[model samples]
Target: MSSHYGQFCPVAKAMELLDERWTLLVVRELMMGSRHFNALRRGVPRMSPALLSKRLQTLVRAGVVERWDDGNRVTYQLTEAGKELEPIVEALGRWGTRWIPELGDEDLDPHLLLWGMHRNVDLEAVPDGRTVIRFLFPDVPAPSRRWWLVISADGVDICDEDPGFPERVGVEGSLRTLIRIWRGDLDWAAALRSGTLTLDGTAQAQRALPRWLKLSPLAGTPRPYAAAG
Candidate 1:
């Protein structure tokens, strides 16, 4: 089969560099600030190490990615040109969130959802101390209406029961609304106004919730998307 995407337009050329099965996804994972090879591999669980290495090499060859030796280990990162592809990745995320089928009733994988949401969150904004955020999914599509999420300097913590901590905040809403808020599709103010979501806790903590999870702007690099073979 011929893989000619035309030879003139820059966009087509760029797509030729990317637009592969798992290539774009690798780029997406890197956009979140992963560098080490193992870290990258862990980020995209569906991708194999062999394929990831090949994709990284392809990207490096195209100048969209740079592989560096950091004393004891090697790492990969997007180049100036590669950073420009952030918008494309963001667009792809939005599309996936909107159209991808729900993971369905039996307790949505909190970690995966949190991983997806982590892309938008500002870790620096989270409180310096411990905090618990409970997600109450009224229309959870399951029998339960409660799930617990703890956030701290370490990262997100998921649990079936509240940890009985003093810094707990309750968010009441449907699973869809929770997902929307997490994805940054709906801002806190709007979600509150529409009554799709509600929060209960210290004003400072409540206010910080949105800022902590806001999406970082995609203002770097231009990379090609390639699929893992």
Candidate 2:
């Protein structure tokens, strides 16, 4: 894990521990309070299980993570040293949100998108009664292509399996389109006009979508973007 920078600086020393692939992301998940192994994997889905395990062990060795047992299952938690990294992780996310130029096809992941949505939905806009919104993403794999977001005054439930509730509205589109929509890179009206995004359901539900759907936290933040040629 040590990549020598050939410098005697503290920054270089820090980089050696933090620069490993998936290391910071694992930290991000931990900082976000994902304690179990499965939750961490969901947060960083593309990382191999073997590698995630290795990364966690490395962090523990570096005094950033601690492994413990609750007498039922093993758990991992961040040490004070790792907790100290919260601001750095957040700054990196904000910086990337503001400066990352473009997104590639490989970057579109339904699991991650839904996970983010589950964590960020604006409950205040939820319908007074039980409301179901389904999404169809043709570009995602069959198992994850369809998603149901069931929300009520009580709470929001995001499900990969069919919740079987009568949906009030449905959104059908490519996975990338949905990702861009959430990221605020595409205008909802323009998307509908272009037929890239389609809405189905009661006129009332259709009309309420734009206002009811709360997007990414960084969606409104102005960023320097680079267009693809």
Candidate 3:
């Protein structure tokens, strides 16, 4: 494989190392700072454990990741070279946010939606010293209606509700609208302007909400791969 890629170019060699179907996604999940096997599985819900393990091994062999055994447990992290791929991963995320088709109701998984939002949110814009934000999912079914989002300094968090925080942002909308906003299909500003999203927090927190949720590419442009399976 390396010889086949050697004939092409450096870019091709890089792609040869990273372009396997689930390899880039595995890198993306690690970029979000998830270090555990189950966390990486949650980040890419559809990936099979066998496939993820294979991709991780491939990455390790390619020197793009380093595996560690901390006494009794194992964890995976990006090597320095792998960390350099952050910009490339972010660019792909920006492209996907702009071009992926809107998911149908049956296709809406709140965890996946939140993961997508987690990828796009500006971590620096989050209020300093605050480690968590509550997401009130009024539209989510009973027993899991509220999400206590915990953000580390890195802006990544475990999406499962944390029992320790107060509700911060009260978003009132259907699951569909929530999906739209999370997927970058709906503009947070326009949603606020239209009274579709109601935010309640301190003035600074309220001000930070829209900026934190702002989308880069304006919405409504049709995705070229709308029908991609």
Top candidate (lDDT):
2
Sort by lDDT, top down from the best: 2, 3, 1
Tens-digit per-residue lDDT, 175-228, candidate 2: 888788888778788788888889999988898887777787767767676422
Model 2, residue 189: distance off in Å is 3.0
Sequence-dependent TM-score of model 1: 0.59
Winner by TM-score: 2
lDDT score for candidate 3 against the true structure: 0.70
Residue-level lDDT of model 1, residues 82-174, one tens digit each, is 898888888876565555534455534444455555555566777667767677777754534666666777876656666787755677887
The total number of steric clashes, by the backbone 3 Å criterion, in model 3 comes to: 0
lDDT per residue (tens digit) for residues 38-66 in model 3: 88998889889998998888888888899
Query: Which residue pairs show collisions in model 3?
Result: none
Candidate 2 TM-score over all chains jointly = 0.85
Task: Give lDDT: candidate 3, residue 131.
Answer: 49
